[model samples]
Target: MKIIRSKSFTGERAWAALDIANMNGITTRLHWTDQPYKWHTNDGEEVFVVLDGQVQMRYRDLGVEREVLLEVGDIFYASVGTEHVAHPVGAARILVVESEGSV
Candidate 1:
């Protein structure tokens, strides 16, 4: 069995991710980032979980922009074609489950 200690996990650069698992066409990854990501909609649904630190999740709803602060243990679910972006507060480690090759 593979064991990962999240508190000790660090990436070489921002948004670096460690592959955890892949089932069917879906993937689970552990991501480390200190920067914000670009706004884009996914090809499939996405499940985002905050493992450590804070993240500001921004999304567009009916052409209006909205944001929420996600702390540890917080989960954000995004449906397909939902335009969104993630901005880490300082540094953050997040768990993401989504379709493989989704952008």
Candidate 2:
């Protein structure tokens, strides 16, 4: 059992994550970032949730690029093969859930 205060969290790098759990084969993590993540596709699905601040979520759909502003409490679900990247508006805290070893 564990209790975490996600509201007060920071990281050393652009996307520093604190592992919270691993159920079945999925991993749940809390991440802190102030920079954009590299554009890439996850082998499995990904669930991105904004816990604090805002983010500009960029992705390509059917060869067309798009972006969405994600604020606190917003969630973005990226299915398998979905090429996407996240650009935090500033310092933001996010919760991510995906396959344990997915890239």
Candidate 3:
């Protein structure tokens, strides 16, 4: 068993991630970032949870670019083929759940 303190975690690089679990082919991770992530599409479904600070989530819906502010405790679900990016307001901790090896 591991007890992780998400707020205190930091990555040596942008969007540092700590592996949390992989159950039944699903993976979970805790990420620390202060920079914006590149736009990309997940090969499978994704669940993004903000644990600390805030984030500006950008996505394309029906070819229209859109954004939303994700605050602490906010959860964003990205279905397969959803193109999205995450821009943290500052230093932020996030929990992400997706299929193993998904981008």
Backbone clashes in model 3, listed as residue pairs: none
State the local distance difference test value for candidate 3.
0.96
Compared with the true structure, model 3 gives a TM-score of 0.97
Poorly placed runs, candidate 1 (over 4 Å): none
Query: What is the TM-score of candidate 2?
Result: 0.98
Q: Model 1, residue 77: what's the lDDT?
A: 98
Worst 10 residues of 3 by lDDT: 7-16
Alpha carbon lDDT of each predicted model: 0.95, 0.96, 0.96
For residues 32-102, write the lDDT of model 2, one tens digit per residue.
99999999999999999999999999999999999999999999999999999999998999999999988
Local accuracy of candidate 1 as per-residue lDDT tens digits, 1-103: 6898886789999989999999998999999999999999999999999999999999999999999999999999999889999999999999999999997
Residue 49, model 3, lDDT: 99
For model 1, where is the 10-residue window of minimal lDDT?
1-10
Each candidate: RMSD: 0.6, 0.6, 0.7
The TM-score values for the models, in the order shown, are: 0.97, 0.98, 0.97
Question: Model 2: runs farther than 4 Å from truth?
Answer: none
